[model samples]
Target: MRLSTTQGLGDEPPETNAASSVRKKPDGAKKVNIGEWIDGRYIIEERIGAGGFGTVWKAVESKREEFVAVKEVRHKWLNSPKMLNYFKNEFKVLERLSHESTVCPIDLVRGNGTYLIIMEYLCGGSLSQRLRHSEPLEISTALLITVRMLDVLKACSRLKIIHRDIKPSNILFADKSFEQPKLGDFGLACFKSELLALSPRAIGSEIAGTLTYMSPEQLNGKKLSVKTDIYSLGMTLYKMLTGRLFFDPELLSRAGIKRAILRPFREHPGRYRPDLPYWLDELVMNMISVEPRKRPGDPQAVLDVIERNS
Candidate 1:
């Protein structure tokens, strides 16, 4: 990756470079001008969103004549070695995973110290946006979405990939039709073998996922497995069904969170929407069980239970 010199950005631009091609923001970050070509292929369009890791942009691949989503690692975050590793690891995981419900990366490119990950562009926004814009989802729609996610989980289990972060933002509709949901953002995902390699540090290492959707083990920084994803999935389902988080943010102290998580959860799907089937409530209850052992062993089992009960 060529590092472009834009001053105080730790990179030196070419000695004879023309100023017209690069535009620097006030914050010292270089912004890709709309219509500018990246890596001689993708044309920058508009920035879509940003998160802890980086900014995402909607771009077009001129040669392929297709629209794509490009995620760029922030210049500030690139200073951390761990963050760099995470960025590369996300590329690896995305390259390895491909399923109907999983949004996998198509390419990773670097230019002037900028790392960009190209992904399939989804016209419909994230599940989080959907939830925020509307009332609680209908039970049928929620179930369909959850079932498809479960299928993705089952595929992940077979592939030995554990998505450490499973939340609403990572779940996206493939298009405006909203018929296909694709799970993206794998920066926190790690292979099961990698977790085993890091077992010594797993117990007390810093947590690496969203707290609101974290599994108990994840919040505690314990060795993770597929069950971790299941717990988050349960939380995601709860929000979809209730349009509210199960745990109140006010009760986030160590003891408070532990107590709330450990205690048998009493709220059911029917509590929010009386029309939902009791079976859904039962499935979610089993999934959100505080003990990892208590949750369904895998997404396959969860799907089977759903089918048998429905």
Candidate 2:
């Protein structure tokens, strides 16, 4: 369930590159209709969000009086071998992770040839929704939310789980007050151990991630590491600071995409929000650096950089 605002193809600009052109084609993933029930356990209430890959439903659990978020991959993709692997990978990764700032899967149920994952429901909505309705968040407030996410990434680093997708919509508030933001959606996560097992074969070459926030390595389908997630988080931070996309989505050429991913931005974050510290501009720039080695060593380092500047 990729809730990131960038996931929509309607927002994608005219595509010149043949590679990106294919993105416009129908994915053939079956859509879960509203009011549907799965395995006689989760009664789908409403579709809270959706993306190119899956749809998320706010559901009620039978025999239990609590609300839960059930994420199900598209039925068509479930039948595809490669897509099936990634879907199962999410379940495997989520089961191993337990963190307050990271949403972990509570249960996995399969019926009718589709997989459903149940998770604790967070009602405050996504950061993307908040950013869409309200004015740009105060710098302090954005930083506070970012710091919490950094803590989650720090934990992921320790566990060798790299969350390839990090964008505004994937960040959810734990309650109505919008104080606690937990990172959700592990569908694109890659464990270092799994990569090691594949060794020199190079983990499957399916390009994953939303366009704007996707890192260079992710775009190229190169060998990835923790730094891949750092690059994405950096882009998410860019949105938190500016309340806008870091790049112009209008250009879809290879050069345009490469420039956006591999080249440093000609504009600075401070240009959007003057109140931000000068160090922050550099910190964010480093996070989105073209080279993985140039980014922070780990999420802890990112936290330290923010601390020193704050």
Number of the top candidate by lDDT? 1
Q: What is the lDDT of residue 162 in candidate 1?
A: 93
Global lDDT of each candidate: 0.74, 0.71
lDDT of 2 by residue, 1-310 (tens): 3212111111212222222213332333234455666556667788887664566888887678678897876544554555556776776777777788878677776544456677889988888888885366777888898899888888788888888888888899888766889998787777887753222113222336666787877666677888888888888788888877566666577568667776655467788888778888888888888888889998889899888878
Task: For candidate 1, give the lDDT.
Answer: 0.74
Off by over 4 Å in 2: 1-33, 196-207, 250-255
Q: Tens digits of per-residue lDDT for model 1 on 174-236? A: 777557988888877888887742331332223266667777776555678889899899888
RMSD of each: 6.9, 7.3
Separate clash counts for every candidate: 4, 0
Cα-based lDDT at residue 105, candidate 2: 75
List the candidates' TM-scores in order.
Answer: 0.83, 0.82
Candidate 1: how many backbone clashes?
Answer: 4
**What lDDT score is found at residue 272 in candidate 2?**
82
Collision pairs in model 1: 2-112, 2-113, 3-112, 5-13
- Evaluate model 1: give its TM-score: 0.83
